[model samples]
Target chain A: MTSKSSRREFLTRSVQGVALTATGGLVWSYLLQQQAHAAPHAIRPPGAYDEAGFNAKCIKCGQCVRDCPYDTLKLAPTGEMVAIGTPYFIPREIPCYMCEDIPCVKACPTGALDHSLEKIEESRMGLAVIDIENCLSWIGLRCEICHRVCPILDKAITIEHHPRKLSKHARFVPLVHSDACTGCGVCEKACPTEIAAIRVVQPELVQGKIGEHYRLGWKIDTPITQEFKAPKRKDGKDTPATGLDYLNQGEI
Target chain B: MAVDNNTVKPDTVKLGPNGKPVRPFVMPSTLVGKLKVWRYIIYRRIVQLGSLLLFLGTVHWGWSIAGEPLLIGNLSSSTLFGIVPLADPFAVLQIFLTQHLLEQEVVIGAGIVLLIYTLLGGRVWCSWACPINMVSDLASWLRRKLSIKDSFILSRNIRYVVLALSLILSVITGIAAFEWVSPISMLHRELIFGIGMGWMAILGIFIFDLLVLRDGWCGHLCPLGAFYGVVGKVAPIRILFDTPTCTHCSECVRVCPEPKVLNFKKAAEVGMIASGDCTNCGRCITVCPENTLAFGLRVQSNISKKSSNKLESNLRRAT
Candidate 1:
C-alpha cells in the first residue's frame, strides 16, 4: 500500500512480475529435472504400470502408500530419489509382500497401477536378479535362502545343479525366471548376504529381449530342422558303403 | 484482526478528545451475540478440520461404512464412500497440459469439483477446505494481534502469473509442475499419508506470510487460489453490497482478506461485489455493524432503484 500505483509504475511491475515468474519457473523446472525423473529403480507396489505410464497417471495422492498393509510402499517425499510424491519401495529395506488381495493397487484412484491385475503373482513390479559373485549358493555354500523365500516357489526361483571343480559335490544355484517372478523383493529381503545378493530392479536394466526374428532351432517348438533337410541324392539310392564298412564285411 | 479497525457499534465506541471513535468493535453483552460474530469462522474451521479428520480417520483408523473406505486420498484426488471421485481441478489441468489424459474417473471428478466451486464460489475451497488456510489465517491473526508491519509490498496479481507459469512448465517438464513442488499439496499430502521433508516448505510459507506480508501466500502467491478465482468468475453466489445500510465506516475494507475486490465505486456501479477475487468468506458480512453486506445470488443483486440512485449520486459527489 505504501508504493505508488501510477500507470507507468503498474506497467513496470507487470514486466517485473513476468520476469520473476519466468525465472522462478525455470528454477522450478531445474528442480524437476533433478528430482522428478523416477529413481534408478524404485520398485513400485504390485500392479503398477510401466514406469512411464505410472509416472504420468499417478496423481501422487498416496492412497497406494496408505493402503499397503505391510507398509512396504512409501510416497516419495521431497528428499527421496524417486519422483516426488509417487509411491515406491526400497526392496532391501521393505519389499512388497505380494499380498493376495493386492490392496495397494485397489486403493489407487487412478490406474497408475493396473487394476486388472487381480492376482498379485502376475504383477511384475520389477525383476529380481542374482549377483553370482556374492551369492552363497554360487560360492558353494549351502545358502538357498532366496530360493526358499520366493513366494512363487520352484516356478519363480529354481535351483540349478552345477558341478564344482575337483569335488564330487554340485553347487545349487538359484535361478530367477522372468516369466514367473513377480519381483516382490521377498528373496531380496531374505538373502543372508551382508548386502543383498539378490535384488529387485526394473527389468529393462538386466533383462534381454530375444528378438522376434531369432529362432532356437534345437528347441522342439521351432521347425528350422525341416527347412535345413538336405536334398535326396540324384540316384534315389544310398551311396556305396564307406571303406570301414566294406572292410568289416570282408573280415579283415 | 486489528481490534481498532473492526466494526464499531454506535453506542460502544468511545469518543476521543477530537470526538473521533476510538477502541472500536467492543464485545457484545450476550454469549449468543458473541457467537454470532464468529459464526462463519466456526463453520469454516469445522469444514476444514472435518475434511482432515475424514482422511486421517479413514487412512489410520479403518473408518468405513459398508466396507467402503471414506475419503481415501488427500485433496489432490480422493473418492467419497469409494464411489464418488473428487480431485483438484487445477492439478488435473496441469496434468492435462503435460499431454497426459487422466482416467474418466479423475476427469469427471475434476468436473464435479469445478462445478461445485463454480456455484459456491471458487476460493470457498481456500477458506473452507484448504488446510493451509488455518496456517495462513493464524499468520494474519498473529500479525494483527502483534501489530506486525509488512516487510515488503507485493502485487495480488502475481498469483495469476504463477498459475500461467505452472501450466506452461508442466508442458515443458512432462509432469504436473506445480503439483510436484506445491507446498499446499506437500503439507496436506504429508499430513494425511506420511511425514517427510514437507513441513519445511509449509513452515516457510507460514513465516513468509506472518513476517513478510499479511495474507501473502493466499492473497498474493497461491496459484491454486488464483486458478479457483478464474474458475469462479461469474459465480452465482456473491457478496451483495447493500448501499442504503452502509455507513462508509471502512471496517469491511480493513477486515477483508482480499480488500481490493471490495472496490466501493465498482460495487456501487454494480449492486454486488463482482470480482472473482472475493472469497465469499463472509468476514465483511460478519464485521459490518450496519449489516451492509450479505450473501446473495449474483443475478438477483440488482439493488432497489432509490438505493441505487442514492449510491450513484454519492459516487459522483465523491469523485
Candidate 2:
C-alpha cells in the first residue's frame, strides 16, 4: 500500500513539474523576444527628484499647462485628475527641442522641472533607436544625416562599416551609436524620408536611472574611427557620389 | 362673539397674524395634539447649534489662511501655519510620504470630521455656510438679474457619480482630486486675491449670469453641490410641513431652489423630509407665509408615513 501511494504522488509531481516547466519556457521566450525588439526611446525628463527637474515640487498645479512655451501639454481631463497638470510631449506635432539650455526646467518654481543639466548629452530626454529595416541607408541608399546631425556626433552617433558588392563606385554605410544617443529625437526630425524612417517611444528604466556603469559605457563606447572612413568614389577626389552609386558601391 | 373661532385650543397653537409669535388654540383633534409638533422644532434648534458651529468654524478657517496653506491635507508646521508654497496639499503629502514621515494622520482626521458631520446633519454644511453654497446663493441672486429661464436642472443623482469618481481617482492615483470641488478652496483662491484666471473663471460665471441662465453653472454643474445632496440623505432633522395649512398656492415650491423639497409636497406623509438634497437652508420656512412649516426631528431611521387628512386639518386649525 505504501509503494502504491508513493507511486501516485510521484506521478502527480511529474505532471505538475512538466506543466510548470512549459509555462516557464513560454514566458522566458516571450520576454526574450520583447527584449530583442525593444530599444531605448525618449522619456520625459525627471522632475524635482532628479536633475532637470520641474520644481513646483509641482502640486500638479495647472499653472505649467498655461505657461508651457509650446503648449504641448494640457490638463489630462477630469477622468485623469491624478495626472492633472504634469506635461507630456507629443513627438509627431511637437517634440522636445533639446535646447542647449533648458528653458522649461528654469520656469518651474517648485522643482517640477530641474535646471541642473550642463551638457545636452547628459540630459536624458530619452534614447533614440534605429529601425534598420526602415532606415534608408540600411536599404543600400545614401542617408547618413542622422549620424551627421547627432549633437554628440562621433560620441553619440557612429557608423558601422559594411562593404557592398555591386559596381565600381563608392562603398560602406553609416551605423548609429546607440549608447551615445540621448534619444533627443533630433535625428528623427532631420530624417529626409517623408514618413520618418525613425521614431521614438518612451524608454524603460525611465530617465535618471543612469549610474556609474552607464557613464562609463558612454565614455568607452566612443565609435571606432575606422568605421567612419568616408565612402570612396572611383575618382576618389573627395567628390560626393550619386545616390545610386552609394547603393551599389561595395561601401565599407 | 365668534366663540368657536376665537377660542384657543389647549393643544393647538396659532401664530399671530404677523407670522412671528404663537398663540395656543383649542385642540381641533386628539391625534395631532398627542404628536406635540412644537417639541420637534426645539429638537431641530438643538441640531442647528452644531450646524451653526460648523459654519463658524469654516469661516474661522478662512481667517487663519494667512498662515495656513490654501488646500487641505497633511502639511508641515514649518510650512508657515501648515501652509506650503504650492497652493494644494497633494504635492506636500507626496513629498512627505516619500520622506517616510507618513503625515497622512492629519488628512485622515479631516476626513473623519467631514464623515461624522455628514451622517448627522445631512449636508448641513451646505445649508449653513459651505463657501460653495454661498457662491451658489450669490449665483441665485444673479439669476434674478439675468432673468434666465429654466435655470435649475433636475440632477439630484449626479453628485453620487461625482463623489464615486473622486474616491476612485484618489484611490487610483494616490492624489487628492477633490480639491477642485472644494468650495472654500475655490472661494479663497478665486474671490480673494490670487494669481491667474482660476479666479476669473468663478467671476466669469457671474458675468455669464448676465447673459443667460441664473446661477446656471452652479445649479447644474457644481460637483460640490452634488456632494452635499448625497450626504444629506440621512439627515435626522428636516423641514416638516403642516399640509392643511399649506394653501396649495405653490409659493414654497416656487421659492425652493432644491426641487426635491418641492416634490415633498406630493409625498404621502410629511414625516421626515430628509432627502439627499436637503440643505437645511430654512428657505422654505422663511418663505412660507402661512406659518404652515417648521423644522422637526424624527427617529434616526423612521420613514415617515403620510399625514392623515384629519391630522392636516388639526395642523391648520392649530396654526
Candidate 3:
C-alpha cells in the first residue's frame, strides 16, 4: 500500500515538473517574440536570404563574422535585440570590401548566405541612396567621390550631367542603379560630407513594390499584330476605331 | 592481511562522527592510482578550455592558427583544416525545423558529431565540452562547501519537455529559440566579443543552482544536454561496480552530481551501473574509499569473472 502511494506521488510530481518547465518555455518564447518583433531589421552579410528565410535558416554561429577579412561583419551583440549571435554589419563603421571570392558566404556552414551567388556583384546586401540636398555635387562642387569608390565602378553609379545656371561646369549627379549595385557601402564609407551624402538602406525598406495586377504590354519584344488577332465587335458595330481615327475624331 | 598492515596507516584515515573513515576528496597517492582517477577530468578540462581558446584566438586576435585564412569558425559550426565540416546537432535541428531540408554538408557534419558522441557517450559533451558545465560545477562545489541544505527538487525528465518545447518554439517562431537565450552560446560570445546584458543570464543560472536547485540547469532544464542524454542511452563505456569490494559507505552517492546513476542497491544486484544518465565523469570512482568502482565495458561474460577476481583480492585483504 505504501509502495503504491509513493509511486502515485512520483507520478504527480513528474507531471507537475513537466507542466512547470513547459510554462517556463512558453514564457521564454513569448519574451523572445516580443523582443524579435520590436527589434529593427539589420543588414545581413552578402548573399543572405530574405528576412524570414534567413532567420529560419541561420544558426547564429558567427562563422560569417570570423570569416570577414576586413572585420566588416560582427555577431549581433546581446543588447542589440536583433537575433542573438547572428552576424550583421554597421556600414558606417566598416563597409564590406566586396571580395571577389566572397569569403563570408563560403564560410557559412548552413546555407544562410545563399551559396548560389557566385559573383560579388550579384549580392543585393542593401541599396545605396544619394541624398542630393546634402551632396556636395548638388551644391556646385565637383565631388564625384561616391562614383569613383564604387566597387562596381560605372556600372553601379554613373555621373549624370546636370546643367547648372550658376556654375560653368555641369553638376555631376551620382545616380545609383539598383541592378548593378551590391550595396557594398564603399561609396557611403568614402563620402566626404560631414553627414554622409549617400547611405546604404535595406532594399526591402526603400525599394517600392509594384502592384501585382499591373503588367507592361511593351515588355514583349514581338509585334502586337503577330501575337494577337483583332476580335470582332460583339454588338455587331463598326470595327473598333484605329489610333489615327480616334485622334481625328477628338479633333473633329 | 600482510599488505593491508603495511599500507593502511591509522593516521591517514580521518574518522567521521560515526567512526567510519572520511571519504578522501584529494587524488590517490600513487601515480597510477592518480592517473586512473584524474585522466578523464584532465582531458575534459583541456578540451573545454582549448575549444574556448581556439574560438577566442580566431575571432578576437585574428590569428591564423588554422593555417588557411578564414577557414575555421566558431564552436557552433566550423570546418576543420578547411575541408572536414562540423556543426552542432542542435543548431542543425533548428534549421531543419523551419527549412524542412538539411543541406548535404550540414547533414554530414551532424552525422560525424553524432557518431563521435555515440562512441564516447553523448552527455560527454555536457561533461567534457560545455562551458556552462564549468559554472555549474563551481556552483555544486560552493553548495557542498557552504553546506546549503535547501534544494528545490524538480524532475530530471523536465529537460525532455524543455527540449521538445524548444524545437516546437523554433518551428513556430522561425528562430533558433533556445540558442537565442542559451547561456552557453551567450558566454562564448561574451568571451570573444565583450559582454552586454547576456552575462545576467549566466549569473541567473549560477544563482539558481547555488541557492534554489542542485544541478538544475544542465540536469533538469537544458534541452541540449537532454538531447545528448537520449543519444548516449546505449553508450558502452560505464562505471562497473565490483560489489564484493564495496563497503556500502555510499560515498560515491555523496560526491556524484547525478546520484541516481550510482543506484547502489541496483548496482549490487546487476554488478554494473547501467543508467544512461551516467556521464562517465569518473567522480564516483574518485571518491570511493574501497575503490570498488572503475571504468569498464558493460559486457555480460566479463562481469562475473571480474567480480570473482575482485572478491578473492578483497577476501585476502580482509584476512
Candidate 4:
C-alpha cells in the first residue's frame, strides 16, 4: 500500500511540475515587461542602518527596538538568526521623516548608526523622486505643498513651474525637482488623493557617505591671531637688528 | 533441642507430646490480601495533577491582571517558555557564555535551579512537574483512542534535528529558539500575536504528534530527553526490582511507558532502575500481586542487593 501511494504521489508531482513549467514560461514574459517599465517604489534603505558592522560584533539584545521613539522597530521572531533585533523601518507605512536631529541615530547605544554627523545634510536617507504622471501637482493643480513644507527646503525639495493644459482654471504645473527631494515621503502624505498620487522612491542614498554636494555653511576654519616680538640678547642689551648686519647681538 | 514459648521440645518429646512448632506461628489471616487501591497514590500522579490544577487556577485567576507573575515573566516571545527550574542548565550555560542574559539574571538564576535539580535527582522534573512532560503523558493516555502507537522508526526525528539546530543557532546568534517548539505557544500566540506563521508551525508539529506519534513529540525525539538522560546517570534514586521474586511475569515491563530500552529487565544487569524515561508512575508496583516492590534509598555497597531483598521481605511481611 505504501509503495502504491508513493508511486501515485510521484506521478502527481510530475504532472504538476509539467503544468507549472508550461505556465511559468508565459508568466516570465509578462513579468519581464513589467520589470522593464516598473518605477521604483518607496522603500527603506537596504542596509540595516543601525547594525552595519560585522556579525561577531552584534549581540542581538533588542536594545535598538526599545530605544526607538516611533516604536516602528521590532525584533524578528526567534530562529531568524540572520536578522534578529536589528532595527528596520517599513517606509510606506512609517517612513523616516528625516528629522533634522535624526533621533534614531542618537538613540542607538552602539556605533551601529554613525553618531558623528549632526546636520540633516550629513544624513543619507535615500533620495526621493516624484511620479509626474501620478503626482497631484503635475495635474495642473495648486500643490506647492511639498516645496513649502520640505524640511531640507531648497536642497531636498524644489518646484519647477510648467505650462498647465489639464486644469480648466489653472495656467501652471508644479514639477518635482527630484535632486532636491530627500525622500522623507511627507509629500506622499500631503497629497489629498485617494491613492496617494505622490510617492517616495528607492535606491537613492545611504548613511556613512559624506554629502559633499550640500556641505553645511557654518563650518569653515577661522585663522588664529598672532603676536610679534623682537629677540633679546643674554646680556639684556637692546639688540640692533639689521637686514644683513646684526652688530650687537652676535656674541650673546 | 530447646523448648520455645508455646512450642514442645523436639528431641525429648514423648509419644503424643511432639509439639507441631506452635502451628508455625501463622500470621494474622486478615493481613494476607491484595493491597488497597490507595497503594497507587505513592506514584504521585495525584500530586502532579493537583499541582497542575493549582497552577492553572493561579494563571487563570491572576496572570491576566498581574501579567506574568512567575519565573521569566511573559516569556511570550520565545519558542518554549524556559520556565520550570529543572531543564534550564542548557539555557543558563548559553546565557553566561553568550552574555545575552546578564540583565535578565532572574531567568538565568531559574535555569541554575533546574541544573541543580538535574544534578540531584534523575529527571524527576520531567516525570513530576514539567508542563510539557505532563502534556506529553496526557497525550500518551489519549493515544489509545487515536489507535496510534509510537514506533521510533516511523516517526520523524525533526524535533531533535531542530533542537540541535536551535542550540547551534543559539550559540551563533545568542537566541535560544526552544520556545518556538512548545505546544502552549500554538494556543497562546493566536491571542497574543494575531496568529502568524510562527504559531502555525507549532500547530503543525502538534497536529503531527496527535495524529501520528500519539505520545506527542517529546516521547520519541526530544533532545531535551537526551539532556535529561545525561543527568539521570548520576541520580542516586532508582526503582530496583528483586530478581529472586521477580517471577519474570513481565508485568513491570508490560506497563512501562518508556520503550523497552528503558525497561528494568533490560536495564537491571547494569544496576540501573529504568532510565530518564521512567516517569515513576508506579504502574508496575500497582499491578504486581506478588507484592515484591518497594521504593528505598541506596545504602552501603554490601547492602545494594540486600536492599531489594529487604524490600521484598517487607512486602511479604506486610502481606
Candidate 5:
C-alpha cells in the first residue's frame, strides 16, 4: 500500500515538473519574440545570409569572431535583443581588411555565413551609400578618399566629375555600385570627415524590394514572341503556319 | 548560557574510536585535512578557472607567448595553438539542425570532444570546465551555509525533456533557439564583453538554485548536462565501495551533491557504484571516514565474485 501511494506521488510530481519546465520555456520564447527586432543597420560579417535566414541559421558560436584577424567581427551583445550571440561588425570602428582566404567563412561551423563564397568579392555584407551633401569631394575639396580605398578599386567606387556651382573646377562625386561593392567598409573607416560621409548600410535596409508580379523583359535572352509560338515542322520550315496546322503536322 | 549541574573538566576531550575528536559536520579541522578533503574540488576549480583565463588572455588581453598566441578562440569552438580543434557537441548539434551539412573540420573537432568525454565520464565537463558550474557551486555552498530548505523540487527527467524540446524547437523555428538564452553561452559572452543583460541569466540561475531549488539548473533542466549524462552512463572510472570497511556512518551521503548516487546499501551488495548521474566528483571519497570509497574500474561482477569466494573459504576453514 505504501509503495503504491509512493508510485502515484512520483507520477504526480513528474507531471508537475514537466509542465513547469515547458511553461518556463514557453515564457522565455514569448519574451524573445516580444523583443525580436535586431539593430537594422548593424553590418553582419561577410557571406552572412539574408536577415531572416541568418537569424534562423546562425548558432552564435563566435567562431567567425575568433577567426577574423582584423578583430572586425564581434558577437552581438545581449542588448541586441534578437540573435544575441550572432556575429556583427560596426564598420566605422574596424572595417574588414578583405583577406584573400576569407577565414571567417571557413571557420563558421554552421553555414550561416555561406562557405560557398570563394572570393572576397562575392561577399554582399552590406552596401556603402555616399551622403553627397556632407562629402568633401562634393564640396570641391579634391577628396577622392572613398573611391581610392575601395577594395574593388574603380569597380566598387568611381569618381565622377561634376562642375562646381561658381567655378569651372570639377567636384569629384564618389559613386558606389551595389553590384561591385563587397561592403568591407574600408572606405568608411578611412573617411577623414568628422562623421563619415560614406557609411555601410545593411542590404535589407537599403536594397529595394521588387513587386512579385513585375517581370523584367530584358532578363529573357530569347525573343518574347517565340515563347508563345508553336515549334516548326520537322521538314525544317522557318515558322509554323498555324497552331492547328502545326499540331496536325506533329510539331506542337 | 545555562550552566550544567554536572561539573566538567577544562581539558576533557571527546574522541571517537579512531582516536580523533568528533568533527563538526563537513568541516575539516587542519589545513592538511581541508586540502585532503577538497583536493578534487580544488583540482576541478583550477582546471575551470585556468581554461577561462587562457581563453580570456588570448582574446581580451591579447597575451601571446613565444611568438604564438596561448589559445585563440572562444568557448563554443576553439583551436588550441592553431592545431588542435575543440568543438562543443551542443553547438555542433545546432549546426547540423540549421545547415544539415557537417563540415569535415567541424566533424573532426566534435569527434575529438565526444571521445574525450566518453572516456573521462561526460559530466567531467560539468564539474571541471563549464563556467556556470562555478556560479552554481557557489550558490549550493551558500544555500548549505544558510541552511536554506528547498522550496521546490524538480524531477531529474526534466532535463531530458528539455533536451528533446530544444531539438524540436530548433527544427520548428529553423534556428538555434536555445543558444539565444543558454546560460553557458551568456556567461562566456559576459566574461569577454563585460556584463550586460546577460548577468540576469547567470543571477537568475544562481538565485533559482539557492532559494527555490537546490542544484536546479544543472541537475534538473540543463539539456547539455543531460546529453553528457547519456554519454557517460557506461564510463569505466567510478567509485568503488569496500564492504568490509564500511561502518554505515552515511557521512559520504551527506557530503555528496548527488546523494542518490551513493546508494551504500546497493554498493555493499554490488561492490561498485553504477549510476549515470554520478559526476565522478570524488566528494564521497573525500568524506568517507572509513576510507572505503575510492575511484576504481567498474568491474563490479568480478570484484563481487572474488569477495563471495573469500566468504566461502572463511566458512570452510571454520568448519
Candidate 6:
C-alpha cells in the first residue's frame, strides 16, 4: 500500500471519487423520480391507501401478491411500469374477485393495505367508467353482463330506462353509480366485447367535482334553498322562474 | 503447536508457487478433507435455498403447518407461520428516515431481526441469507479461476458514505431511496414471486464483480452490508484468534472475502478478530492449517486456548 500520495495525486483521486459519486447520484435520482410518477393507472389491491401513500408505505415485499387467492395481484417487475416491486392488478385479465375476507390486504405487513377496511364494499381501488357509445345496452342490445357480475349488485350498477329511437319498448342501460361502486373491476372482466365497454380506472381520471356552489334543489334530498325561489308580483301572484323551466313548478 | 514455517510436516498441506498456503475455497485431495472444506458453504446454501423454497411453497404449493402458511414475502419483509413478522432493519431505517408513518408490524419485525442479528454477528445475513451473496461469491470464484485482478481500488468505507446518502436521499425524496433501486431486492423479489427484468441488474453485478474488481458490489458498495457491519460491533459471536499456534500461513487472508478484518498484528494483540467489518464467515477458521482461528464467544483477552475455554465455560454457566 502507498504510505502517502503527493498533493496533486490526492487531489486527483478526491475529484475522481466525487465525480463518480455525483454521476451515479444524478442517474439514480432521475430513476426514482420517473418511477414515482409513472404508472398512474395501476389498480392496487383492496384497502390500498391513496396512490402517494401506498407508494410511500408499500415495502414492495409482494406478500399481498402471494396471498391473493385468485392470482389477481402482481408485483410490478423492475422495468415493466407500475412502481417496481409494488403490487398491482390488470383488471381486464383477472379482476379482483372482492373476497369477503380480503386475504391480499390482510397479508400486507405494512399498512399499505389499510386494516380498517373491514368490509369489501368499503374498498375504492378505482372507479368503473362506461364507454356510452360502444356499450351493448347503449347500442340497443340486452347485454348487461357487467351489471350481472358486479358483487355490489343493483346498488353499484343499476339498469335504468333509456328511450330508444325506433323500438316501442324502453332500453335498459346499465348505469354505474359512484356512491355504491367499490371499483372491483368485475364489470371490466365480464364485458363480452372485443374491447371491454366498461373499464376500471383511477377515479381522478374521469370524476369531476361539481364544486361547492351548484346544488340541484329539484331532488327530494336537496334542501329548499331561497336562491332558486320565485319572487312575488304586485298582485300577490308568484311569477315562475324562466330558466330550467321544468324545475320551476316546485310541485315535486 | 508452535510449528516453524521452515519445517512443514509431511501431513500438513504445502504452500502455493508463491510460498502462500492454499486457499480454503480450493477442493482438497482427500475425500474427507473435501467434505470438511465445504461444510460452511453447504450449510449456507441449505439456509439460503431452504428459506426461498419455504416462501415459494407457501405461495405456489399451499405449504402450511396446521393450516397456517409458512414464510411469506422476500428478504425486505416477511412473515413466518402467519404470525411472527421479520423485516430488514436497514430497509425499515430507510423508510423511517423518510418520516412516513410505518405500521407496528414492520417496526416489530425490524426489532426482531435487529436483535437476532446483533447477537449472531450481524453480517450473518450477508453470508448466510442474502441472495446477492451467491451472485458475488460466484463472481469471486470465477475471478480466481480466470486470474482476473481488480482494475481499480475502492475504499471499503465507501459503503458507509452510501448508507449516509441513502438516508439523506430518503428525506429528500420522501421515499426509501435504496429500497426503490436495490439490486438485492430486485433479485430476491423477482426470483421467488415471478419473472422480471431484475435479472439484468443481477447480471450487471455479476459482471462488475467478475471483471471490474474482486468482491466489488458486496464488499465495497452494498450499504446493507455496511449497516450490518456497524450493528455487528457489539456482537457476542466472534472469530477467536490463537496467535501462538499461528504459522503465518496467510491462507485465511487469501480465503477471506474481507481480508483486512484479519490484520494479524491487531488480531494478535486483541486475542480475537475485533473488527466490526469481519463477517464471521469462518473461512479463516476452516482454512488455517494450524487451527489458529475459531468460532467462539467474544473473549476478553485470552491468547491461549486453555484460558479461552475457561472463559467460555464461565460465560456459559447458569450462575
Model number with the top TM-score: 6
Scoring the B chain of model 4 against the true B chain gives a TM-score of 0.60
Better of 2 and 6 by DockQ: 6
- The global C-alpha lDDT for each of the candidates, from Candidate 1 onward, is 0.82, 0.47, 0.77, 0.45, 0.76, 0.84
DockQ of predicted candidate 3: 0.42
lDDT (Cα, tens digit) per residue for candidate 4, span A63-156: 3343344555443442332232233454446656565666555433323355565765555445555666766667666776766766667656
DockQ of 2: 0.04
Q: Model 1: which docking level applies? A: acceptable
What is chain B's TM-score across the candidates, in the order shown? Answer: 0.88, 0.58, 0.80, 0.60, 0.84, 0.87
Rank order (by lDDT, best first): 6, 1, 3, 5, 2, 4
Candidate 5 C-alpha lDDT tens digits along B1-319: 1112111223355443223443434657899989998999999999989988988887777677766666765667776666667777876776567545555666677788989887777777788789999889899889989999988655777788888877766666556657656889888866864566788888899999899988889888888888888887877776787765655556776666666667755666667677777777887788876777888777764586479458546756766
- In order of TM-score, best first, we have 6, 1, 3, 5, 4, 2
DockQ, candidate no. 5: 0.33
lDDT of 3 at B14: 58
**DockQ rank order:** 6, 1, 3, 5, 4, 2
Task: Judge the docking of candidate 2 as incorrect, acceptable, medium or high.
Answer: incorrect
* Higher-scoring candidate on TM-score, 2 or 6: 6
lDDT of each residue in A81-128, candidate 6, tens digit only: 788899999999999999999998888888889988999999999999
Ten contiguous residues minimizing lDDT sum, candidate 2 chain B: B72-81
Off by over 4 Å in 5: A1-22, A31-37, A56-59, A132-142, A162-171, A192-194, A209-252, B1-28, B60-70, B193-195, B300-319
- Model 1 C-alpha lDDT per residue in residues B82-138, reported as the tens digit of each score: 889998899888888878656787888899999999999888888888989999989
Candidate 6 lDDT tens digits, B90-208: 89888887777888999999999999999988888889888999999999989989999899988889998888778878887877889999999989898887888999999999999
Q: For all candidates in order, state the fraction of native interface contacts they contain.
A: 0.59, 0.04, 0.56, 0.01, 0.33, 0.69
* Candidate 6 overall lDDT versus native: 0.84
TM-score of every candidate's chain A: 0.78, 0.51, 0.75, 0.48, 0.72, 0.80
Q: For model 5, what is the C-alpha lDDT against the true structure?
A: 0.76
